[model samples]
Target: MRPDAVVIGVGNPYRRDDGVGPAVVARLRAAGLPGVTLAESDGEACALILLWQQRRLAVLVDAVRIRPPHPGQVHRLVTAWPVPGPLEPDRGSSSTHTVALGDAVRLAGELGRLPARMLVFAIEAADLGYGAGLSPAVERAADKVAAEVAAEVRTWATATADQGP
Candidate 1:
């Protein structure tokens, strides 16, 4: 049977900090948690919604290109939509090839495709230049975020099982 929840790391690994999402996905797979599907995508909104369809919970991690002080910082937003309201904005690191995260979430919400419970982890990015390596700071943060995500996945899995099919 498929897991009750899904954690998706979205970003392009070729772009420095932008690769954080996929990096976290790699960590989760290494840990090998049962019943939780670990996956990575190109950070496209529609694809994200499809990947998370009908799942009870979804955790999404992405590299955010915020300003000075905010760069290298990690923030989590729990909202049905992805607007920047109280949340800070992250710039597009790679070439414009996809929809903004907020826009995607809004589209999903409008189309009634968002999961029941969702958590978005946005890590401020330092450099987005064309490269396959992360800045020292963002690289350090990858592990911390990965660990937190794994623990959350485990907790969510347990809680979901307790509720029963």
Candidate 2:
């Protein structure tokens, strides 16, 4: 059976704070949220689209580098399909990926493969250098983001259940 929701963690774990996405996935895995599929990606556009397709809800966690960085600040947004441009305007194409998430989102919109709802949780990074661990602040934020994702999954599950088959 297909999962009701998927959480795609987009980043490279070896790149210090860029690993925030995977870190959150790890937490969710340990928590074991029912009917929630957890996945990690290197922010590849096509891979990302494939991961979330046909799900009722898709949640993505990733790292972003913004000016005057705040190491662990979390930015959350719900994308409107057929997006006009960057997911976050002021941040531009700020994702720490070769092909931005916004690009994948745009492609999904064009292909009409979007999930019923999509949410993004972008964490600010303090370091992107090659390493295995996230910065202290980013580490803490990862825990928080995991909790947030878990809550979201539960809420989605409850709402869907309430609607009945």
Best-fitting candidate, measured by TM-score?
2
Reference-based TM-score, model 2: 0.96
Candidate 1 per-residue lDDT over residues 55-126, each given as its tens digit: 888898888765444555778778656444433344433222357777777778888888888888888888
lDDT for predicted candidate 1 compared with the true structure: 0.78
Which 10 consecutive residues of model 1 have the lowest summed lDDT?
88-97
lDDT of each: 0.78, 0.90
Error in Å for residue 104 of model 1: 0.9
Model 2 worst lDDT run, 10 consecutive residues: 84-93
Clashing pairs in 2: none
